[model samples]
Target: MAEDFTPPISQMQSTTLTDDSIQFENFSRRVLIKNIVGRPDGGVGLAGKKVTVGGWVKTGREQGKGTFAFLEVNDGSCPANLQVLVDASVSPLGDLVPTGTCVLVEGELKKPPTGTKQNVELRVCKVLEVGPVDPVKYPLPKTKLTLEFLRDVVHLRPRTNTISAVARIRNALAYATHTFFQKNGFLYVQTPIITTSDCEGAGEMFQVTTLCTDAEKVERELKQNPPPTEAEIEAAKLLVKDKGGMVADLKSAKASKEELDASLSELKNAKENLSRLEERSKLKCGIPQKDGKIDYTQDFFARQAFLTVSGQLQVETFACALSSVYTFGPTFRAEHSHTSRHLAEFWMVEPEIAFANLEDDMNCAEAYVKFLCQWLLDNCLDDMEFMVKNFDKTAIDRLKLVSSSPFERISYTEAVKLLQNVTEKKFENNVEWGIDLASEHERYLTEVIFKKPVIVYNYPKKIKAFYMKVNDDEKTVAAMDVLVPKVGELIGGSQREERYDVIVKRIQEMELPLEPYEWYLDLRRYGTVKHSGFGLGFERMVLFATGIDNIRDVIPFPRYPGRADL
Candidate 1:
């Protein structure tokens, strides 16, 4: 008898919809985008209007005589959720409706029962079946779930409440960013992605290469199949000689191997050959020799290039020309950071202001953040509500805090002093006056010491960028980083070192080549002015705003190291 029995729930509801039956003209209320989500007050009260709402059905529940399906409908214009109740037995096309289908609810609007959670619920009149949805195969289950679980199903996350909310808030941040810059008279700029200059000065970068050459692929095949035996090494050397050089030109423009044998051949020979030959090879290849001088000719470009870690340097040049310029685009870092906060490729919003100093930069960052917060409150209430209910309940309160209070500012020296004296000691890099503050130290200062966001400034010159202006003491630079409670460091900035001689001397002292940054130094020689700017990790800011902890969650299609699944 148990084997013959079936679950009563399976027989309850069965209707589906698609693009065909969703008649736009028949929807009693041809709802405009703004009315449905943007402004509820302006919408003809859902109480008595004859309306039709169309969206992907979330779940359907049945209880004997009636059926209820919670419709998570969106026009993709906003994050507002419109719940439609379908008790279609007495209405048209109700008997066959199923969950997880495209739905068009032609109904009479009524306020949800006085005690229920939703403000308005559409009472279904005519249900249109336009497509089919299989419950078991559907991505979103009708059960309560968590964001962590949803992340594993990356494709389905966008349909979940937390992700839905994240999407809206992310959009709001983008809009706010543009609006803040535009209103402030800053020229919105788009920088190149495939740039020749590694703006961050950090060596970590994803090398862009074309398709693999037949010779390169063959070399790669030999390395993988037979392993590097003595014969394979000799064969590789022969191939290098035969191909004239590395497979760069031979490889197709669309494919690239990780390391071409030709490039590696030079290194292998240098290692195995005589001291004189090794020295000559190192010079010819421009390769770095241990305890030896830099070989210029061997350097690609007879120079160096890597993915930019920050746009501040490049954007600063524009600021010199435009007096006020901002760059909002992708920045990359090559650090082997296997952490949530660091991404190999992340978006940064950097603003450079001419004739401005540290104070001006702080004001701009604060004002920009505040404007974004206010914009989210006004524009993304639905997303905000969804996040509060599903992701983090404290997110709304945090945004409010940002809007109402001025962010605190402290010097790096003071931060060091505070950390050194703290009774509770768990710092991995023990707090010292001149040492760089690790992420743990930053969190302690921002989350515990201040109990609010704080900007720590004037870091020791040794740890900061070379362009930062040296302070009166000469040991510290006019650098600052804004730290939020959970998001450790949100922004890093400085008043640029503008004097030509000072910058040159600093470069020399830092042991970085004057030749590579010759163009950058020319700015000071020509018409350099007092200027300041900061680089804000755009994704991190979104994380702060939406209460999404993982940096990967904020970015759409994240490209972290060794992970490039679209």
Candidate 2:
């Protein structure tokens, strides 16, 4: 009976069989538009195949005197849209001829007539579903949009060519990051989002506390162990009255001192219980404070903590034992910058290596940056080209140059002298020997002077973080910064100070409190090795690879001053 059973094909939702048709999950009963059209030949080879596809109509118009409609549909797999022809009888042409209207239909793939734009066209036979759009209400139109304008409608910008390509490019870069680090034998470590170490600087971090959260906690506790009600307090007072009356009776009857003392003790106990009830009646809900400060012990972590600006300190603990380790995650900064380059929240790629020094740090940074660029060139060239056509012309060129060219290395002092010697250009910041180089100076070294990626090392000890290894001159630290053409300081790194007393003195000289760094110092006190590490701004990598001028455009959701849109 089972072998003889045959199922009837439905006319409502039909899909014809073809040997070459692209297959997708059948719950939606549709295939991705990418599979049907994104091919080396624009899917010309798969002519006459029957398949179902779903996508938002990028542009649609009624043709042939309203008898039929031509729709350009895209599912965001690639930039190209598939040409679709729908008859008026199959579905309402009015609904299908609006921009941003979602259409899912089953059709036969046919080769288009000669001299047309598309190689193949879909002759839609069955209109499975239609999501009508109000053309006037839709923010995205056929007109080109500026990057700044796109930020206003960020939720809808991904439907555009620029943001969608950025999404793909970002995905490729993230995948490449993990692949490169994993392939290099670096163990991936997820450092804490909330951390205690202020490696960058104090007061620049977003402090993590339970200020409001603990107040709610106190409210919950008060509800569970509520204050004494009026009725309960009255009953306790009545008990005290009864005890006092007994004590008075004992005194009037002139009873033995023991009896009188016993009555007095009962009265005292009743009054003490009443006092406790009265105290409970005065319940208040707020964050407990000690010495005019919100007590951190009552906070979530039981001490002051903050969103980490960098994972360098925590990942170093892992690198000491594992030999090499890297952390990739979002870091937060409370910087009040409204610049195109700054974000309140951004991603960081920090890698630490044991048994490495300043030169090793520079080499590691260079190789990592090169690998990221090459990865983009190999995997996301299509998206890169899209950016090249739309946003930045030198995007792909920049990627190729970084991937193929060797980076030039120079010392910090030498770089400063070089910048100072440039009589043609005057830096906004003074180019002194001890002063930290500004973005202009860095760009001069990389873009103008070297015309390639430049690694500047051995920065002033006073300007560098206390963790950096002090050089023999005792005036500078073993630090390095990888500067590129557009982004001046792409990566910053250093060989860590391994000596305990030297670092302790360095910490003191910087006027930093030593309590927060005890655990970091324990790595040096117990067993220390020559470890070096650097942090690469992951968003900057996206910026570098795509040649996008603004840092906010590359990330999916940009968080900055006065803006955190969903």
Candidate 3:
């Protein structure tokens, strides 16, 4: 026989107030709806207890021959709403009977009718505060709203069921990520949001600049001290040459070493002055420029910089020192993609482990993913249940499957072969050996062929990032991507190239600037070790957990192309 999951009202009635009640005493002066409604005792334990509650009214209606009203209120602590009964004599019933109206009331907890859905409800004795909302004026009403419509009103969407549930789920995942990494001895490192090195080297980066903000000042300065003309620059160079000749003449005349040194120093100062004049002469009426190049020295940082595409490169430095480290923060990409999986700004959880290989990388990725799934199942079951009830019915099952099952692993070559063999369905992208697997191909492997999470490794060198370790065959790199059912690729990782020569060759072969990566190469120069790491797109993870189709809806304040609403 199966055990009864529901707790009896009698069992709940025996509960007593504890530390949680004491903590919120000074701060809120009210019981949170989640505590009263979500308690195992069904709030029966606190029946007849006088408590103050504050929340926005979700729905309210006049009843009992128009003498009183019942308002369903939620404080965003949980999915369930607490029922509050207010009499017409207590306050203006009209003010308390509108949706979105906020209220603070002193009430007595009382048991609802035995067969009712709610185990307890609040009977209000005094209305302390009423933040009324005019039904005709409020934008959000008691109606079903599409996620696309809510994006326009991002600030108020959290009050909705879908967004609130997603918020809770997202929070749970972040907390779980920190807990898992910290428990495994991984140090959390804060990587810079503005970085000089492009981690992907793709050049799709948002340039961080103050030039546009100070365009007026730059234009004014340009007019006040216009850049020197070609003739002026030539004149300065001639003067520098004359100074050099004088210094040389002093040396030829067998003058004292100090006198010769003084002449040489004067020449150096003259050359510097000429250079400064030439630089000032090049400044245009728009952005500062020199020799047709955007002079970032005039901009902030004294060099080119951009919002980071990934924290992997910076965190790798810390990993080399700490042995194991991770960075969790917002990363930006300037891809013009408007797809369901892309975001202009999104968070990334990147973990780099020293002395780990591709296999170890895959294991860590799998384990961390499974840990997140289990964490949601354990700590956020209520929100998960709400999501299952509304958004995705299979969400809970999917979590269970991922949490318990070991992910399937295959080489990139094997995956391509398998994909090609599937003749029943024609793929949009070609399934060739060296071609990069598209989302369609990835989904087919995880959803159709394997029907589970799949880890594809040993990707072709030409298709992967330059930092990935090249295999012995020299044809492919030791890279891996973890593909799940709904989201094709959730995690991308690889064992870094530890050999100094190999990495330099890879960089040169890719035609990337070696100067930007000099610091990264220094890690190999001094103390090189076989290290592996992976990055999990945080928004994609939220989309997977919530069953929310659009990536924009999962994040609190989404940033996409031409859309950065509050």
TM-score of each: 0.74, 0.87, 0.85
Please give the range of 10 consecutive residues that has the lowest summed lDDT in model 1. Answer: 18-27
Candidate 1 wrongly placed segments (more than 4 Å): 1-34, 37-44, 62-80, 85-99, 105-107, 111-118, 123-131, 211-305
Over the stretch 101-160, how does candidate 1's per-residue lDDT look in tens digits?
666667776666668666666777887544467666876777887655765677767766
lDDT of 3 by residue, 149-180 (tens): 89988999998888988998999999999999
RMSD of 1: 13.8
Using lDDT as the measure, name the better of candidate 1 and candidate 3: 3
Poorest lDDT segment (10 consecutive residues) of candidate 2: 5-14
lDDT comparison, 1 vs 2, better candidate: 2
Candidates in descending lDDT order? 3, 2, 1
Instruction: Identify the candidate with maximal lDDT.
Output: 3
Judge candidate 2 at residue 444 and give its lDDT.
Answer: 88
User: Which segments of candidate 2 are over 4 A away from where they belong?
Assistant: 1-30, 216-282, 285-287
- Each candidate's number of clashing pairs is 20, 0, 3
